[model samples]
Target: MIADIDGNASVSNATGKPLTKRGEATRTRLLEAAEVVFAEQGYHEASIVKITERAGIGLGTFYLYFDSKQSIFEALVIDLNRRVRHSMAEAMAGTSDRIAAERAGFAGFFRFTAQHPALYRVVREAEFVSPEVLKLHYTRIVEGYEAGLARAKESGDIDRRLDPEVTAWALMGMGELIGMRFLLWERDENGLPPAQLDERVFTAMTQMIDNALAPRREGNHDD
Candidate 1:
């Protein structure tokens, strides 16, 4: 991550500016608080005061990191987007095959979603508040996914006929909806989403993915 000396509320991706350990900690706190405030109050209702209170920081300190409500909101989205992708990438890292990688990636996604329900809310709100950032989120994920899928296709890891771009988007959409249903909407007695997807459900979803992306043979029913 880089820094913007120009004083953006959040960190920038371009410059290689480094923050002190305390500065990084403070920034993390602000983003976390913003997550809770946005999830509970929605973008329009959330205020700087509320975020600072939730973060246990002062108004002046908030300015040091972020300039306004929107800036912080955008930062929050970026933070969530980066973390979720990291989770997926890390999970997929050691997988031995394309199918395993996909399954692991989705598992990571759901895990992050369950742990951070605010992700869904903040992203949806970005459509209205910051559509560009919203696009950045999906496009960034798809770029990395397309690269991996392209490599897998070249190596016969997945169906050679599959278009990497289309497949990447389709898989992402599938994961999003499935996560929304199983990880976000499905709740326990206390009304909290499960920390992990059920084993049975996970198996069912992975089976479907395997069948969908696996290459076809002459005797296959789809043929």
Candidate 2:
């Protein structure tokens, strides 16, 4: 499970109570089931029965935590939001430079995408199922990215001219689209997405980010 900045266990139930080991496992199972079902069926067609069935739980068990289909879907989105952020944070940790952090962060994102292909599809459904949840998904990502970029700029790690919030959104847009095209769409002979980013493409993309975000040199004339 993910944790707060203070390092406390972050797993909780619908009542906001810290979960027992068993409760945490159950919630995780339901969310994982929802991920697969939502990605396969989309929100409009995916029902609570399907989620519970996939989760191998009875109908009554679902209501113990979530009230309805919409509730679970929203919860799923929130859960995914936490998870992806953690993935990015963990990857960027201890990297030597801002560009290195960016490359590592995007690598984490694509790794999650390859394993949980449901990410793109479920987030897209949030546009109709719950617009606020869609915004929540994006804003959470931007919050982390903006904070990191702000620090990097202050430390002379990245271009000071770049606005942290704007740069965050731009970099997020780049990562999502790249994951969609290269990771989601690329398939092997067995019709499965590759488990890693292509090395050449990763290097090229990181070079572009380095150029865009690198601090301007004193002798530089190009805008």
Candidate 2 — worst ten consecutive residues by lDDT sum? Answer: 1-10
TM-scores for all predictions: 0.90, 0.91
lDDT of 1 by residue, 1-223 (tens): 1122223244532133456778889888988999999999999899999999999999988888777788888878878888899899999998999999999999999899999999999999999998878887888789889999999989988888899999999999998988888888898888789999888888999999898788666476565
As for candidate 2, its clashing pairs are: none
Off by over 4 Å in 2: 1-18
Lowest lDDT sum, 10 consecutive residues, model 1, at 1-10
How far is each candidate from the true structure, as Cα RMSD in Å? Answer: 3.6, 3.3
Q: Show where candidate 1 strays beyond 4 Å.
A: 1-18, 217-221
- Model 1 local distance difference test score: 0.85
Which candidate achieves the best lDDT against the true structure? 1
